[model samples]
Target: MKANVGTLDRGLRIAAGLILIGLSLSGVIGLWGWIGVVPLATGLFSFCPAYSLLGLNTCRNRPH
Candidate 1:
């Protein structure tokens, strides 16, 4: 997949994902927190299916 996620976006995704997972594990949030995996994976992989489908690109170093 193309790297549509940029550095800032990736960082935010990762951070948000980790926070959600942490909250879930700590019981601060319900199982829904597991959804954080989506962002985490997209962030780590630098590819977001939704972004691709929406024709959005945030990575300056990569071409859509």
Candidate 2:
């Protein structure tokens, strides 16, 4: 899949995912924190399925 998530967005997702996972491990947010894996996967893959369905593209133009 194409990279629909931009650099900054990807960075934020990674950070948020890590934070959430950390909190979950520490029992700070209960089991809900484990949901962060979704963002983490999207961030790592640089492609969001929801974004594609919504026709959202944050990636800047570049020679392909």
Candidate 3:
């Protein structure tokens, strides 16, 4: 998939995902925090399925 996530958004997502995963592993946020993997994957890949479906691209340098 094309990159739909921008730099700032990707950074935030990665940070949030890491925090959630860390909390989960530390038993602070419980198993549900594992869901952070979704954001982590999307951020790493620079793509978001939901954004594509909604036609909402945060990327500013998409090729025409």
* RMSD in Å for all candidates: 1.3, 1.7, 0.9
- Each model's backbone clash number: 0, 0, 0
- Give each model a TM-score: 0.94, 0.92, 0.94
- In terms of lDDT, the poorest run of 10 residues in model 3 is 55-64
Q: Which ranges of candidate 1 are over 4 A from the true structure?
A: none
lDDT of 2 by residue, 19-63 (tens): 999999998899999989999999999999999999888888633
Model 1 residue 39 lDDT? Answer: 95
- Candidate 2 global Cα RMSD: 1.7
Q: What is the lDDT of candidate 2?
A: 0.92
lDDT of 1 by residue, 11-63 (tens): 99999999999999999999999999999999999999999899899998864
TM-score of 1: 0.94
State how far residue 22 of model 1 sits from its true place (Å).
0.3
TM-score head-to-head 2 vs 3, winner: 3
Model 3 segments more than 4 A misplaced = none
